[model samples]
Target: MTDDTPAGRSPSRRTLLKAGLGAAALPFASPAVHAAARDVKISMQRSSVLFTVLKVKGTLAERLAPLGFTPTWHLFTSVIEPMNAGAVDIHADVADAVPIFTQSARAPLTFFARERGSPAAEAIIVPADSPIRTVGDLKGRTVGVSRGSGSHYVLAAALKRAGLSFDDIRPAYLQAPEGAAAFEQGSLDAWSIWDPFLAFAEAKRPVRAIANGTGLTSYHRYYLVNDSFVAAHPKVVATVYQALVEAGQWVKANPEAAVALLTPVWGDLPPAVVAAANARRTYQVEPVERAQLGEQQAIADTFLEAKLIPRRIDATDVRIWTPPAVKG
Candidate 1:
């Protein structure tokens, strides 16, 4: 896999391994005994630090071992397209707005888990010396943002709150690394992005956030699975969900340990920056509920209004998988 580092620098093999470019197939039961164990392919992103922790700890693999399955992790910079195409069985997590775009494409996917809202985790930022002090100042300025990312919605909502519209700005659709490069090179007037990247930029450069998704959006992240995977391996899905819940609890209870484990995998980000980014995320994994989809619907509507999505869609129309109840 290619390195995600900005500025066209190549990553060493060791760094790539640490960054999870090499698929991690955790050991199951005795090799001789479970030689035929099925592989449960899981896709992970650097921002989803909980999955990084779990992958490093082999937590999901351990949990699925008894079910005759071994966990294999594949790192990804963007997960929606691969997920929709059935390239991965489970998507670690993605911004709230991602699933909406996937659903609009009629992808057969199901929401299994979500992190509670951490609205401040994402923001619209400008260089410290830039004259764009407020969201209204963004009108007609070039803004760098990932197309269909949660930060995209953050920019749109922030603009609307300031009485501006999506069409008022010139958008540079870019991934995190490219956006950072452009923003630092003075090519972009502003950038809309989420943490670790957000935290990393602040540490390396002078920037200021003009607005984040506070009242505008909850910024909840969601985990999804291809519907075919759910049908073929319901029990495995349940086990993975339970593992995520426990992993979330573990990360919250042991922040320092989580940071230490994640720093290397996240491109050796400083421990402090990793902690700051983690601080902005709730990481409280919970089952996706229909009632909680209000923000999702709002996101879909906003994207539709902005003409970012191809067509209108009912955000709650997708399938949801509920975990089994906990035993006393």
Candidate 2:
């Protein structure tokens, strides 16, 4: 548990629990929770990662708690690790990973929720004063990204669109927070990262976005479940989606309050950055679209070219999707 300050400072989860619970301020109505009062056990990852914002707001649990469903918070450093090990039933992640996971497994993971038209939620960043003004300038410069994550895909796509190959740049493999710190320290030329880490770096350091999901692709965030989870309790899935859609709408409408609510989870990171990132993000619960499939196919092809994935895969074969009506 780290401290709750977002300035790359520590804000332990335990501290937030103490403070938020002490206030005893409940945020949701009972019907939201009671929908599954006795049938489901709902939980979420409790890390500072953006996908877990639902847990941070305490709204996800608040919505599900009174339903007789208690949310057990499982904290992990890497999201993929938990998803792979089956430690968590449902994983909220980016669409990029689906290409890799689908290529490797049978009956691939299915997405139930997507954030549509959320441009600039992810980006390649450098100091505002730095001379690297455009994507073309990124060539031959050091670009940092997590080896097997959404940021990695964004960097690949951005570089490809710039008519440059991965060979043209010095790639630094690092996690979001690590890469952000390196960029801020001037040790790295550019960092490819997702929010609120992206937001945090931009505010605390001299960083500016060279490019985001614009002109490249829509890097969507997804809520994925095992095919079995979808099979057994479809309504549970729909309920969660409905709650998330409501939460996302609330977030878009009340950025300041949302930031304050998330501060306990993000360690009090700067509110303006969070708000900016939120404003740029479209947190909608839409079904995965055909374009997304094409984009994911492109990602898999790129990863194959980069030798990141072991083999090429058909992006569509792994998907298990339901109609928009089935979701919130």
- Residue 27's lDDT within candidate 2 is 20
Q: What TM-score does candidate 2 get on C-alpha atoms?
A: 0.81
Error of 1 at 60 (Å): 1.3
Best by TM-score: 1
Where in model 1 is the C-alpha error above 4 Å? 1-14, 21-33, 326-328
Worst 10 residues of 1 by lDDT: 24-33
Which window of ten consecutive residues has the lowest lDDT sum in model 2? 21-30
For residues 1-328, what per-residue lDDT tens digits would candidate 1 score against the true structure? 1113433233576776646643333221222237888888787765767777777887776788889998777766666677668787887588888998889888889999899999998989999999989999998999999887899889888887788897888999887778878888899999998887788778778889998889889988899998998988989989888888888899889999988987777667778888988899888989888988988999999889888888989998889988877322
Q: Give the local distance difference test score of model 2.
A: 0.63
Highest lDDT model number: 1
Per-residue accuracy of model 2 over 1-328 as CA lDDT, tens digit each: 1111233654565665543311112221223344445534232322223435565555556655544564544443355644555555556445454446544545335666676655577789888889999889988899988777777878888888889889999999876556766777788998887766677787786778888877666766666776677777665666677777777777777777777876555545566776776777777767666556777777788888887777788775555566548535
Q: How well does candidate 2 match the true structure, expressed as C-alpha RMSD?
A: 5.5
Off by over 4 Å in 2: 1-7, 12-68, 95-99, 102-108, 289-292, 323-328
